[model samples]
Target: MKLVVQVKLLPSPEQAVALEATLHACNRAADRASAAAFESGLFSRNDLQKLVYAELKADFGLGAQPVVRTLKKVVDAYTALRAAIRAGTLGRPGCVRRVKAESKPITFRLDAAQPFDDRILSWQHDASTVSIWTTAGRMKHVPFRGNADQLKTLREHRKGETDLVHRNGKWFLVATCEVPEAEQYEPVDWLGVDRGIVNLATTSDGHNHCGRRLGRYRRWQARKRAELQAKNTRSARRRAKRRTKREQRHATHANHKISKEIVAVAQRTGRGIALERLDGIRDRVRPSRDQRAALSSWPFHQLGEHIAYKAQRAGVPLIEVDAAYTSQMCPRCGHTARHNRPTRDSFSCRRCGLAGPADVVAGVNVRNRARSAWVFVNTPVPQGI
Candidate 1:
């Protein structure tokens, strides 16, 4: 499993200034490389390296690795733009934004051959600090702290490149760690999980994690956001942005908690998990304006992603099945009709007279699908969200 643990850095004022200057120098180089790449119509890393490597190194007084990393960022942006254009997701290739020294994340690309074995960037075991390479041609030990779980991972499983991020007057090191995959568990039965806007998640065992509180929070945020926009003042805008970030954090934390609960349920019951295939759901449905915001704001995809990784980390079997009629189909008698779900939150099978929470019915149907497909594909495969 791959996860990023964010460790907060505590740098002295002088050290902070040096870090900021370095960030500015790197971003300036990146912007120059971006302009060159787009104007020359050459986006390959090698080509970009040839174009700006020496100039950026001498002009910005940057190291060879930082120059290469900066140019690669430009190359990656153009590459993604070209791909999106070709895939018809975008009409045309767009201009890459100039990296702002104040806001852009400064990535320290550690060489793969060297790995992160504490040479360029290493942890000081005694000081609870990290020695990071800077543009000043010296390594500075910056004290850092994090939550117990994050610190534990840094002490034990730190690996790969770390990104230095400056946000709201704080420095953070986002470090990615590679952990061994969990041992696979034999499945006893299938656990169906239905994700919806009304209820964040519904399990086949008749559990509903409702979203009323989230909905109210969103509505409140929307109103405050509108008010802030009306003010059009700098402070109001800043406040609005901060509120939005807070709301996002709340939602993300809620998702993690909900996913943890679902995984725990599956683990305790000794069952695999089955979820709806939700790819491209947003584009597939057209809702009224009144309903659109709620639907669009729904975190079904996020919930699914969280559940997937957590389930994988716990060695719980998980699979996605087609979601054609899982919502309306009768889990008890195999009856399928839109009228089965006459209301948004209620479901009744006209044929079998079986009725219950609409989400639970959907959950049951998903479980049935998993049971039917168990013979073909039995184990969970960890994949990207």
Candidate 2:
């Protein structure tokens, strides 16, 4: 399993400015490379990287290593942009073009041997200071500090796939890890999950996961945002930055807890979990401002990811089914009719007069669909009884 570990970067003022400049330059180069590729029929990522790396070295007077590193960064961004385009996520091509124009000059990537990694000592909790290894040698340990709770997060980077990023005047580490493929298991029972804005999630088995806890945090965030907006002073802006960081930390902690609960529940049940293919839930939901805020705050994708990884680890299966008519279908009669689901909260079948909670009905439908598919696929049944 590939995992990423992220730790804080303690760059000196001069180094920080230099790094920012490099990043901006790399972003600009990537934009140019992407545009060139789009215009020229031969715009493979390699071609773009080669072109940009040479340009940075000759035109910008960057060293060979930095030039190569920056080109890699540009390639990464290009990959992300292309993916967004392929996914139909880049709504405005013009916007992408414009962003690319500004991006080429602003962002860059660092090599694994870059001075950034040499300073830190394997990222331990007890060590209060870690140095960034630079070409000049190990930088002095800057008195870096974070809350004790963050220590737990440091240990999560088991696979060391974390990325170090400098953005918007701050440094951040992001970890990306792949969930291992699950072992073959017998498919007998399935648990369906219904994720939403209001309640967060409702399992097919009559369990409800509430978003009210996140709602409370949202309210607090709103207050903080308003407070920041009210003040135009530099001090207020600085304070706002600190507030934003604090809120992000708290939100991440909450998500970790919620995700852990979801995985725990799935593991304990020892059954496959079924979820809707929520590829475009944002557009489908078209929620109100308050609703959207709450929905955005909740980490539905993260929860799903957690469930998938944990289930895989525990040898449980996870199924993704079409959500189109799951909410409307009558679980009793398997009838796909609009009249059966008269309201958002309640499902009543017009043909059979079946009544039940809309979410519960949807969950049952999801479970049934997944089970039917599993049986049709003839996936191996788990051993034992």
Candidate 3:
């Protein structure tokens, strides 16, 4: 499994200035390269580099590797944009967003992240410091700190390029690490997870990670964001952006905690995890205007992602089961009806008189589906079936 460990850089004031200049110079070079690529319609890495490499090195005071990295960044940006357009994620062809995106060249911020290879960046794990090449000069012995696990991972499994990012008046290096997955055990059963807006997650075992508190926090943040936008000032907009980031951080933290607990339970009980296939959920549902914002902004997808990675790290098997009618279908009598759900919170079966919390009922349905699905998945097929 590939994981990224972020380490905080503690550079001296002079080193910080050098790093900042190097980042700006690289981004400026990238902007120039991107403009050339757009005008010439040449975005291939080698082609683009051939066109602008000399200019970037000579004009931008960047070294050989920085020039190479800058050109690669421009190429990657266009490649990603093309992919997004092809996937229809930017909207259909000739639509306003798609047209606008295709019409202009991609641009990077002045403080954009810069990638460094081993030749340009050297790490001294024992000294907890790094020596990085910059436009100003090579800065050596710049201290850094991270959690014990992050430091250990960086020392052992860190590979590939590390991105130097400047955000919120701080510098961080995100290093990629490849960690081996533990051996998966045979599952005695499955733990189903139901994801929803009101309840972030509810398991088949009847444990719930309620979203009431998070919901309130988000509502408060939303109200503040609206106020800031209403003011229509630069500083107000900046504050709103910071508030948005804070909310995202909080939601991410909550998900990590919830997923860790769920994975721990599954591993201890020798149970696999089953989650719903929730792709295209946004396209499938419609809600009132008031509910639309909340529904659209919900972090249900992030919760699922957290659960998946944590499960993989813990060597717990995980699968996605069909989610169609999970909430309304009765686990007891196989009765399926929209009327089975009397309210958003409660579920009742008309045929078998079975009842439970709506979310739990959905989770139980997921577990039942996984049990049957696993049997077919693992059973060996006879010669010709």
The TM-score values for the models, in the order shown, are 0.86, 0.65, 0.97
What digit string (tens of lDDT, one per residue) describes model 3 on residues 4-92? 99999999898989999999999999999999999999999899988998999999999998898888888889989999988999999
As for TM-score, the candidate ahead, 2 or 3, is 3
lDDT of each: 0.81, 0.64, 0.94
Evaluation by lDDT, superior candidate among 1 and 2: 1
Ranking by lDDT: 3, 1, 2
In candidate 1 the C-alpha lDDT for residue 150 amounts to 76
How displaced is residue 247 in candidate 1, in Å?
Answer: 2.6
Candidate 2: stretches off by over 4 Å: 7-71, 78-90, 95-104, 108-132, 139-182, 230-252, 285-298, 335-355, 379-385
Ranking by TM-score: 3, 1, 2
**What digit string (tens of lDDT, one per residue) describes model 1 on residues 1-385?**
8988888889999888877777777777777777777667777899878888899989988887777666766666666655755675643334343223212333332221111223457777568888876688665678998898778877677777777777777888788888666886988998999988878999999999998899899999999999999999999999999998988888998899999999999999899999999899988989998998888778788889999998998899998999889999998789899999999999999999999989999999999999988876746666984
lDDT of 2 at 251: 62
RMSD of each: 6.0, 6.7, 1.3
- Candidate 1: clashing residue pairs, number: 0
lDDT of 3 at 301: 91
Provide the lDDT at 179 for model 2: 40
